[model samples]
Target: MLRIAVPNKGSLSEPAVQLLKEAGYSQRRDGRALVHVDERNDVEFFYLRPRDVAVYVGQGIVDVGITGRDLLIDSGAPAIEHLELGFGGSTFRYAAPAGVAASVQDIHGKRVATSYPRLVTEHLAQFGVEADVVRLDGAVESSVRLGVADVVADVVSTGTTLRAAGLDIFGDPILKSEAVLIRDERSDAEKIAVLTGRLRGVLTARRFVLVDYDVPGDRLEEAIAVSPGFEAPTVTPLHGSDWQAVRVMVPRADINDIMDRLYAVGARAILATELLAVRV
Candidate 1:
């Protein structure tokens, strides 16, 4: 059976489970359950802290894990990012007192506070700056006010936390992070591919909708140009000899514009429906 590690708490947990469930895998109903076995799929899920997920997978304790890209890199484990899961998005950056430090070089010879000390240290090295790294578990933004550090390099989601602490982000982001699937370099390839494919399908389903419309046979070519799908739109004969039905997948963001274009090209009975799940 394939063993998978999932974040047990924090921002990625709920969405991770929801995605798995949407992909037709059974999830543990009890939040505290350490492990859940999905016998039908021949898989086992191990609940773990987000930071430790990459390590567990890298050590061969679990076949693969779902964790934030920042956490995965900070751990420095022997794992490869199998796929980007696209949630828990944030930026790791350097911030300091609004009018004090204007760039990363300004923090040279100064102390910087952060939960991710390794990431901060490595990034600073690239700029030839050597600043003391004050490691804090949380509330890293407050370190500057409290005099624990002159600056901070930490996660910035909306920058609200940085603003609340009277800090301003400066310099280019150290890393742009989001949730991702990680696996040991030598994990079971076939099994991992299966799970990855399923998750990919669910993500695709969430980002697009099925579009169906009918067009006069004479105008079919024009309408097809407007809604050419992932591969090609499916065309079928309609009851009226002079008309045809077309089915295609449209990205959720482009649905309205595609609809208007189809309408302008002599299409009718246009419909868009959300996809529950998909394999292709």
Candidate 2:
């Protein structure tokens, strides 16, 4: 059985589970359950803290895992990134009391608090600035207000938490984070192939939807040109001789606009449906 690690808490967990479930894997039934078996695929799921996912995969205790890019890099674990899952978007940045100097170089010899000590240390090192890194698991933004650190290196999603703490972000971002799929370097070829194929199908389906419609026979070429699928649009003759049925894949975000254009071009009976998975 293939073992996969998934986040147990925080912003990335629910979405990660949903994606896996949509891909036909069952997450652990009990909230506190650490391990689960998906009888259909014969795969094991391991619920883990986000920060520890990369470490577990790196050690080959799990074949693959889902985690934030920031946590994976911060853990400094030896693993290979397999895919960027396109969710849990955020940035790792330096934030200090508002009106402080605006660059990492200004924090030389200062103290920085963060849960990601390795990422902070490496980022600051690039600027030739040496700051003492005080590690904290949470409440990183509050450290600056309490004088425990001169600045805080933390994940900023909306900048709301930082602003509420009276801190302002400075310097270029240390790293941009999103959910990613990662695999152990030592994973077997069969496991790698199976997981990669399933994940690609899931990711592709997440970005697109299946669209079907009817159009006049004369307008078929124009409609096909606009509504091209991953390869080619599927077309079938309608009951009426002068009409045809068209089915294609369209990007999820462009559905409305594309539908409007197709309508203006004589498309009718348009329908949009969710895709379970798409492989090309």
Candidate 3:
């Protein structure tokens, strides 16, 4: 059985669970259940703290896991990113009291606080600055005002928390973060392949939809040129002989624009539907 770890709480947890469900993995069958078993695939899911996910996966206690990119970097875990899941996106940055004169170089020889010590340390190293890294689990922004640390390295979603703490972002970003599927280096090849395939299918389904419509034979070439499918549009002769039925797969984001273009080109009866998955 393949083992996977998922966040049990925090910003990335719910969306991670929903994405897994959409990928045909059931979760929350019983309230408060921390582990879920996928009967069809002999897979086991371990619901763990967000910070611990990368540690478990990196240690090979679990074959794979989902966690924020920031958390992964903070954990300093050796794991390969299997896929960027594209949710819970944010950035790691330095923040200081509003109106304070602070720059990346200003922190040299000063104390900095952060939940992500490893990421902060590495980032600071690149700037040739030696600052004491104060590791705090939460309320990192308060460290600046309290004078416990000169600056803080933390995740910024909308900069709301930073502003509420009377802090402003400074310098270039330390790291850009998003949810990612990752696997341990020691994971078996077969399991890795299976997991990657399933994740790819889910990712593909999220980005695209099936589009079907009818057009005159003369317009077939134009329609194909306008909205080509993954490879080519599916075309079949219609009863009128001069008409053809066309079906294609298009990115969901491009659907509206493509549909308008198709309409302008004389296509009719256009329909669009979500895709569950696309296996290549």
**The best candidate in terms of lDDT:** 1
Stretches off by above 4 angstroms in model 3 are 98-102
Candidate 1, residue 223: the lDDT equals: 95
Q: lDDT score of model 2?
A: 0.90
The candidate with the higher lDDT, 1 or 3, is 1
Looking at candidate 3, what is the lDDT of residue 137? 88
Candidate 1, TM-score vs. the true structure?
0.97
Write one digit per residue (lDDT tens) for candidate 1, span 37-107: 99999999999999999999989999999999999888889889989887889988888887778888888
| Model with the higher lDDT, candidate 1 or 2 | 1
Question: Candidates sorted by TM-score, descending order?
Answer: 1, 2, 3
Off by over 4 Å in 1: none
lDDT of 2 at 234: 88
RMSD of each: 1.1, 1.5, 1.7
TM-score of each: 0.97, 0.95, 0.94
Tens digits of per-residue lDDT, candidate 2, 223-269, equal: 88778877889899987478999999999999998899899999999
